[model samples]
Every structure is written in C-alpha cells, then in structure tokens.
Target: MGRSPCCEKDGLKKGPWMPEEDQKLLAYIEQHGHGCWRSLPAKAGLQRCRKSCCLRDRQVKNSLAS
Candidate 1:
C-alpha cells in the first residue's frame, strides 16, 4: 500500500524553519511531550508537516550533543 501523506500539501510551510517556529515547537513539546507527530504541528501552531517537526527535533538534539 502507498504511504499516507504526512500532512496536507496546500498552504503548508516548506524549507528552513524560522527561529520562532523552532521555539514554538520546542515549547509545545516541552509542555505536553511528544504526544503525536501528526497532530503536534497543528497543536504547536506550526504550518509544517509532522516529518519536519521530527526532523527538527532530531536536529536540535544533535546540535546539543555536539
């Protein structure tokens, strides 16, 4: 079976995330934990896909590890 789309393509933000966007995502996950990737973006008020959030989270972790 084909994979389901991570998010709706229309009107969604693409490319690098702004610092504010990263902050919002980080704050939301800190408060609520990583409940659900698919829904977290909407809950966090981000116009990004769940995959983007996951990737961003990983990037943040990697940066901190360095």
Candidate 2:
C-alpha cells in the first residue's frame, strides 16, 4: 500500500527552521498537546508537516549525539 502525503505543499516553506519557528512550534505543542497533525500547521501557524517537525528534531538530536 502507498502512504498518503503528509502536508499540503502549496505555499508552505520547507528547510532548516529558525529559532523563532522552533520556539513557536515548541510553545504551540506545549500549550496544545499535539492533537491532529494534519491540521497542526494551521493551528500552530507552522509551515511544516508534523512528520517533518518530528524528523527535524530527531535529526538534530542525532547530529548532536555524534
């Protein structure tokens, strides 16, 4: 079976996120316990997919570890 694409790649920006973006995402998740990832971009005001956010964090952590 094929997997569904995560977020809408319309006008959303994708790349290495800035500190402000990271702060906003962290604050949003802290305030709102991560409900629907599909709708998270709108709610959290982020241009990234929920999966991308998670992957970014993991990548950062892994890089730091090594």
Candidate 3:
C-alpha cells in the first residue's frame, strides 16, 4: 500500500514560508519549546506540516550562518 500522508494536504501551505509565518513558528517554539513536530502546526496556528516546519527551521538556521 502507498504511504499515508503525514498531514492533510487540503488548505495546507506549501513552499517557502512568509516572514509572518516564520515569526509565528519561532514564537510558538520559543513559548512552548519543540514538543512534537506533528502537532506543532496546529499549536502554532500555521498551515504547514511537521516536515515543513522542520525544513523551515533548518532554512532559518542555515540563513543565520551566512
């Protein structure tokens, strides 16, 4: 059988995140810490998946390196 989707794709945001999204994610993480990626989107009020959040975090970290 095919792998199940990590999260519902409907209405979920894809591609690069906006500045406000970055702020929301960062703020949520700061306030609650990284509890669970799977649940973080709903908690953070973002329309992304756990993997997307992780990638966004990684992207932020990489950007900071330069």
Candidate 4:
C-alpha cells in the first residue's frame, strides 16, 4: 500500500497532545461513545487519524503492562 499523509496540516493539532487533549478525547468517548474516525479527528481536536490514535492507545496499554 502507499504511504499516508503526515498527521498534520489537515488541520490536526500536530505534535504531542496536552493532558487536556487526552482528557477531552477520553471524556467525549466516555460520554457519547466513538463515532466515525474520519470525523473524530476534528471533533476531538486531534491531528491524528483514527488508525493512528488506535495504535497509540494500543502501545500505551502494552507499555503499561511491562
């Protein structure tokens, strides 16, 4: 498959997310639940794709266990 675009420029708030960013994303999902990833980036103020976000969460979980 072809490479995808960088996780920025598309209006995503690139770089690392602050604690508030993480809280907001988690809170939104906890209250309302997940929606389409294509729309979630903008809605959640995240510059990452749904796929990237999913991967990041997975990595975080994995790291915590070790």
Each candidate: RMSD: 2.0, 3.4, 1.7, 3.2
Best by lDDT: 1
| Top-scoring candidate (TM-score) | 1
In order, candidate lDDTs are 0.91, 0.74, 0.88, 0.65
For model 2, state the Cα shift of residue 26 in Å: 0.4
Instruction: Using TM-score as the measure, name the better of candidate 2 and candidate 3.
Output: 3
Report the lDDT tens digits of candidate 2 across residue range 1-66. Answer: 787676566877777788887777767777987677767667888888878877765666587699
Q: What tens digits encode model 4's per-residue C-alpha lDDT throughout 1-66? A: 887665644665566657776666676666766767667656777767676665655555587689
Off by over 4 Å in 2: 1-8, 57-66
Q: Candidate 3 lDDT, tens digit per residue, 1-66?
A: 998776567889877689999999999998999889999999999999999998888888799898
Q: Candidate 1: give the clashing pairs.
A: none
Off by over 4 Å in 3: 4-8
Ranking of all predicted structures according to lDDT, beginning with the best and ending with the worst = 1, 3, 2, 4
In model 3, which residue pairs have backbone atoms overlapping below 3 Å?
none
lDDT assessment of candidate 3: 0.88
